[model samples]
Target: MPVAVVLPGALNPLAGCVPPFDRCGARARHATGPWASSQGTQILENGDAVDLTWVESAGAPVIVKEESLRNLWGGYVNSDYENACEVDGYAGLVTFGEPTATVTGLVINEIPAPTAFMEEYRSIVQWISSSSDARFVEMVREGIASVSMWDEGPIVRVNGPLAIFDAALPGTEAGADELLLVEIESDTPAPARESIGWIP
Candidate 1:
């Protein structure tokens, strides 16, 4: 069985559609550290390498949990914020998915604050809303809306299946901001072990 790892939205474009697992013979000689045969797993370094086992596991197609979705979106938001901002006080929630064989739990973090952090977050949300890709908004509407640590300080609760405009406000407790939350959910339940195969 062939495997492909599904990186979060932030890394997917750079990772390409197929797994980048076998790079040992390439001119660049990418190194994916250690293979754990017992667990039927391979660990790749954090760069652009892919893990076939991870891909196959995700290929099984299973529903992810709400908390898990929050984490995934939060992680992507943090990474993007870090690269753009460079401080721990700024972040954004891009998208999220439910728990599944491929992934589980919420991934959240504090990103370095950037001077234009709010603007960047607003731009990202606007981009998603206006993008031609309907799937982007659809996925977000399926799961719970997650707020970053920075956004959470003033928010008590996010609302709706499509909570794009109801996210908590960063400052001033009196009103909600225009920040939107995109939820990601799927009907596919967790896959059975028989449905997944391990690579040697």
Candidate 2:
């Protein structure tokens, strides 16, 4: 199960929690079509239904209503997507203490919006300025905190609106530095449930 999140030692708050994706891939990676009908609940082999959230997946961030699990923030819907950071493989997390090397870009308050920081690098402000979905706009409130692309991709990199990496760009919070960006790494996109990880 290539479980991506890798927080060190006791630093990980969501230690015992079940990561959304299994070795096969993400449970509810996309959010559309039949997936939208499922409404964030997956049925077990024993005929039980479990509530799903925007949890983790092996590869490829999804935003389609049918394909997306629930929330825009992939991987366990915590307080804010920023909370899990490294635990979810996102860089530029909103840390509580002083800034770490992974952090960069403008401090949260200084920027007009989270998307502002990426303007220089990706030109996201233009797209965000035209969005209508409030949640999509709200999605960028967290991090990639590295918000620093690894010569790889955008910060949110989600499938929904604010997903700069989504090819639909747009686009946090916390302490003074907590608002600062952090480091992010990219993983190869996992094929759909039946392709690479899970057996159809």
Candidate 3:
């Protein structure tokens, strides 16, 4: 009917310009994983929400939760910390500050190449010699961040939680004292899935 109807308030087209699902409140909760662990989500808020996976070790202060917005709101250039950090599981953006590596690719122990082929086949030879138990996570490295496990020294404690073989690490330069190769081991068992988007 065209009869006059009361409205709660004048419908301002500008009102709710931000989509409900896209709108993020200042409040943030742990998206997933244990408190302050490597394999968890740390959500941040601006107009858009950034789902930052805690790529480093456990127990590191949830710094990004607070600091991420400052760069956007404060009208300052994004520091290297923000630039080097990986977002949305893409690689090639690992930095020394966070050192938490996240890759949106398949992580597996080994790739058993075709073994049924001829003995002289390159594929068969590569498959037979590859260690079935060898484990590694592959991701893109931006700028100078490289991952190598061959230069062995200590078990590479990334950001301090994920202990990859030393071969999987790039050497940190000297005088970078904060880049300590910790021998600490986390008792927390690995999760079945690579990522958890909910935190309680």
Model 2 CA lDDT for position 152: 26
**1-200 per-residue lDDT for model 1 (tens digits):** 11111111221222111211234522111112221121222233323222112101111111112321233332212232122122222222232233343332111222100000112122121111212223323222232134222213111122212221111111111122221223322332332111111111
What is each predicted model's overall lDDT from 0 to 1? 0.20, 0.23, 0.18
lDDT of 3 by residue, 24-121 (tens): 52212122222223222223222322222222211111111111111221100223323322222211222233336322111111211111111111
Q: Per-residue lDDT tens digits of candidate 2, residues 73-100?
A: 3223332223432233222333222234
Score candidate 1 by lDDT: 0.20
lDDT for model 3, please: 0.18
TM-score quality measure for candidate 2: 0.20
lDDT of 2: 0.23
Q: After best superposition, candidate 3 residue 188: deviation in angstroms?
A: 18
Model 1 scores worst on lDDT over the 10 consecutive residues at: 111-120
* TM-score to true structure, per model: 0.17, 0.20, 0.17
User: Residue 39 of model 2: what lDDT?
Assistant: 28
**TM-score for predicted model 3 compared with the true structure:** 0.17
